[model samples]
Target: MAATLDWKLVVDTHDAPALADFWAAALGYEVEDNSALIDRLMTAGQLPEAAVAEHNGTRIFRGFAAVRHPDDPYDEETGIGRGRRILFQDVPEPKTAKNRLHLDVHAGPDAREATVARLESLGATRVEEVNKGPAGHWWVMRDPEGNEFCVA
Candidate 1:
């Protein structure tokens, strides 16, 4: 038998919190809140105040944020998701090329347009449309920071 390992998708972004919020809303996920852990670290004099910041009234790590499936199990003490998560980490460089890998969101047959529209309202830009005959169609879209994802 093979050993099982857990994993998460991590994206580099100029603004971790913003990207985390955008993805959380887009995927119906919840933003992971690490305030309790940060507070504990600070109280123990192990973390500096400059290492955290207030985002939307929540204190989060300065260069990282994450979102997880709302129903996924998570650690109560640290708010770290144990399953189905995406972590956004701050990068000094800007995104200048197409993503090598991208996410595909399925919205069934009738909800594609509405789903795309909703995503647009949340800062996604339509890049183009893809049609594969019998394979069906999907919209190629870019997130606020230019990462591409598809809605089908």
Candidate 2:
């Protein structure tokens, strides 16, 4: 029998909040709140004050953030998504090379240009465009933190 698992994509960045905001805008996803949980931890003295930060009037994890699909189910109390999610974790070093594995955003055949423009406005830089002839075409882009992903 095959095993089933729930998963999320994790990305390392120098600034987790900024990258989380950028990706949330790019994918039309919602930023996971986690404020309620943070508040509980803080009140119980289980979490230090230095381990949290206020973002747009909400308390969030200091070194981590996440974005989730808009329609996904999530926990109301904890603000954690129960479906598709991307977690951004803080790391000291900057991205140094091309990503071996990258995400491909599908915008259908006609919406590619508009999608690329929107992504560019959201802090993604176009690295190059690839035309595979009969196969298809896609634009390679780097996110704000230099992680690569494709828009097709």
Candidate 3:
């Protein structure tokens, strides 16, 4: 039988922590805290001091950070989400093309405008308004790092 597997969406960013923070607020999720694990790894000489950095007084992997659903289960030792999550990893290259995959946030009909405005305040830029008449309506938006997503 095919087995179900836990998974997370990974996003490439120039600044992992900042992108993670933005997504966490945008999605009403919580930033994962993996400081304890980092500390243990560093003490064991497994991870180098240069591999980590301080964020909000906690140590995070220099090139990675993540956000998780607030009500989801997670590994206490590693701070890894077992349910819904988004992992951000740093990449040296800038975004060069439109995304083939993107997130569509559902805010329903009445709240679309308000939701779009809120997202804009959170560092997302409005790319365009997409109106499908009877099918649906949404706003194409770009995150701080220029990743595309929609608010519908």
* Displacement of the residue 150 alpha carbon in candidate 3, Å: 0.3
Model 1 scores worst on lDDT over the 10 consecutive residues at 1-10
Per-residue lDDT of 1-152 in model 1, one digit per residue for the tens? 54324469999999999999999999999999999999999999999999999899999999899999887789999999888899999999989888999999999779999999999999999999999979989999999999999999
How do the residues 70-132 of candidate 3 rate in per-residue lDDT, one tens digit apiece? Answer: 878889999988888999999999999999999999999999999999998999999999999
Q: Which stretches of candidate 3 lie over 4 Å from their true place?
A: 1-5
* Candidates ranked by lDDT: 1, 3, 2
The local lDDT score (0 to 100) that residue 114 gets in candidate 2 is: 98
CA deviation > 4 Å runs, candidate 2: 1-5
Clashing pairs in 2: none
Give each prediction's root-mean-square deviation over alpha carbons.
Answer: 2.2, 2.4, 2.2
Residue 124 error for model 3, in Å? 0.5
For candidate 2, write residues 1-152 as lDDT tens digits: 44323469999889898999999999999999999999999999999999999887889999899999987788999999888899999988878888988999999779999999999998999999999988989999999989999999
User: RMSD to the native, candidate 1?
Assistant: 2.2
TM-score for each prediction?
0.95, 0.94, 0.95
| lDDT to native, each model | 0.93, 0.92, 0.93
